[model samples]
Target: MTIHELSPQRSAALTGVIPPVSTPLTPDYEVDTASLTRLVDHLLAGGVDGLFVLGSTSEVAFLPDSHRKIVLDTVTHHVAGQVPVLAGVIDMTALRVLDHARVAVEAGVDGLVATAPFYTRTHPAEIELHFRTIAAQTGLPLYAYDLPVSVHSKLGGDLLLELASDGVLAGVKDSSGDEGALRGVILGRRDRRDIASFSVLTGSELTVETALWMGADGVVPGLGNVDPHGYARLFRAASNGDWEAARAEQERLLQLFELVNVGRPRMGLGSSALGAFKAALYLRGIIDHPTTAVPQIPLNDDEIARVGKYLSASGLL
Candidate 1:
């Protein structure tokens, strides 16, 4: 596959609500291309600025290489340049991540997102070298994913700024849930005269309004898969400086986020939350089956009912 390049103008437009889109699967755990296309259409119609595939919300870690390729191919082909498609090359090291990054680049993804290496104990200097090396090798716009819960490493604001200044990172996806760190990155981008157009997107769904107010360029909410229009409305409200409207919308979305808690006591955090997102999508008829990958428990009938209640209460059903 031939890798295409994105113009500076096109790369600069990577802002607003870009969902870490879920990878729909058949009962046999095969990639459901048709359903994935539908989901992309759903998000595009809802006014999202871009599509992020194979991220945490997409269950990238669980997907086999073939399934990951299927997802990247399907979304990139379907989107057809209507919006930027950012693919996540998540792995435990630079070499493995580069393999996936090559595939994404060949698939014509607008950019790549990856977190610091995991599984083995690594140093901050190593993490910096990891990103710098990947950026140099791929020659594609790279975004640092600060997902401490999953990656086990919190990408500090200082490192993030240094990367931006050095042109090693095009942006950052801060899911660390640390308000101080998030603010630091946002402020760093704002105050830095050398780094221009470094996007700082918040993956903190519960506080989209707050992140935006704190100078975040956009949001990559997992809940956006369930309620894309809602996030779109919230983004526009906040971006327009209408805090009152943004607050109301965000509060409603926060209520919707409560659905993730429905599976907490019985299932692991990933199982419960991801299953709820899939279940909600299934219940809304957006996808065929809510079945997640193996080893991760699926939401039972009772828990699925709770998801429906959340949608209904949010005026989605």
Candidate 2:
């Protein structure tokens, strides 16, 4: 049986608010260790259950290999295991992902999150082998990041459930944005046979209450990087069965989510998002610089002012 089956309690502990952390960069695009240190402390102070590094929100697609290592090492060192750190080993193929996995393992991360092989038309069986191969190579627990928009493939509930049952997957971070499909996976894991432990974490930050109410184990909200306390409160309220309070918190977060849209038309979605996240952090004085990776448009003063307004209205300022 899988380790999760052998230790069911450990699986239960995986549930809660785990935010996908944004990598704070210096003006020259280097990883700002000081800002990152502050960011981790910020999350922990907000009572986050865990930290996720090298995710889409961290601009993993734009970071080079050296920068990726810096981010993993810096975050893992700062977090110091106070809470579990799940590192994203995202790549275009299984072999490429293993390279990242090895680094994460050496960095002392608690878990690995990977996307299905992308940039090539891969068969379903290959995809299955992809996850199984990675799991076999690294003894660390594996999480499937189901981000269809980025991976160009949607992992069906049946496949994910089967993987979890067989011990190849420990959890899923569903960024697919398809509520019905995610609910299917959530409910399937509940009804599926021989699946002892699995986590269902939603990446859609806007409707966290609905996601939690539908039985998601937790959230990996990108917005959580900006206001970890808000997400934490939402999770606590939901866990306490305070749906009314949870709904109110989620509504406020929905308003905060609007900050991401402050940079549009002049930049791509990815640029806008990373820029907005760093900009918000800067406005809050959590980070010194709001520099995004190359090729991503920076938020102008006017756009950043809009982000400040969103933060103020949400009471973050």
Candidate 3:
């Protein structure tokens, strides 16, 4: 669909199984164009509704701006009308983020995933202003990405509603795993003043069914990258009001998370989660190897072994 503006309804329609897709790389750690195309095709064919380019899984922070642009262009091109491609417009500063948003616009992305600013201690008011400025510049519907554990600011529902009131952000992907906070964003305003039919996506696949049940309009999950069918099943079951089926799938996913996320540390390094996820994909024969960029530490044999064991025991291998 030749979309010029970010379509919230269109996005929701593509929501059930959106993968925070990995940035495919060659052995030497270059963007593997062929692999990326194949990966996108595989995901779409395997039942992923859409794809998220440059998310945590995509290693946006590790990639240079130019490479980020190329990655966006490649994914958007390969998506080729089969599904919407949401590009992550994450950067160090507001100006740079605006620049990235412009790149996303030029690259033909369906939407922009703008996470909270990191490194600096940004206040709630300033965070509000930052999103306002970026939204004013891009005019693309923005998906507020709130992974407080990874970013600069801790988001509350009040801040999200404030931004939505200004038409600055269209929706949120609350990776914070705080159900109450997510609920606030969803039920913050009923007047539909600024943005009518606002959206909120849950980034926590482990609790995505719960989030959706709690009023999340969409879900953008990392685990969906590895197991799109499973996530899709969960989303469909939830939407169909099949509580029993949804609960069953959720239990299965929780079991998987317990295995993969066991003993995983919370660090700002950006490599830990990505490494494990890539290794999981590798073990599943989805990728060749898990090659992180410079300054990003590669998972040692022990860590890989843990991930391997997790997958094998879960019967994913």
Looking at candidate 1, what is the lDDT of residue 166? Answer: 81
Candidate 1: residue 63 lDDT (0-100): 98
Clashing pairs in 1: none
What would the per-residue lDDT of candidate 3 be over residues 1-317, giving only the tens digit for each residue? Answer: 12234323222223567788888777687887776777787688668777889988788878888789889989988788788788899976688787788888899887788877778888777777777777766757787888877784767788787777666666777788788878777667545556554677788877877887877766787777667778888888988999889989888877776534432564333567677777777777777777777676777777877888877766677
Candidate 3 stretches with Cα past 4 Å from truth are 1-14, 189-196, 259-270, 301-306
How many Å off is the CA of 238 in candidate 2? 0.4
List TM-score per model, in order: 0.96, 0.96, 0.87
- For residues 140-258, what per-residue lDDT tens digits would candidate 2 score against the true structure? 88999998898889998999988888888899999999999999987887765566478888999997899999989999999988999999999999999999999999999998898
Please provide, for model 1 over 53-141, each residue's C-alpha lDDT reduced to its tens digit, 9 standing for 90 to 100. 99999999999999999999898888999988999999999989988988998899988999999998999999999988788777788
The reply for model 1, stretches above 4 Å from the true place, is: 1-13
Sort every candidate by lDDT, greatest first. 1, 2, 3
Error of 1 at 65 (Å): 0.3
**Order of quality (TM-score):** 1, 2, 3
What's model 3's TM-score?
A: 0.87
Candidate 1 to truth, TM: 0.96
Instruction: Please report, in order, the local distance difference test score of every candidate based on alpha carbons.
Output: 0.90, 0.89, 0.75
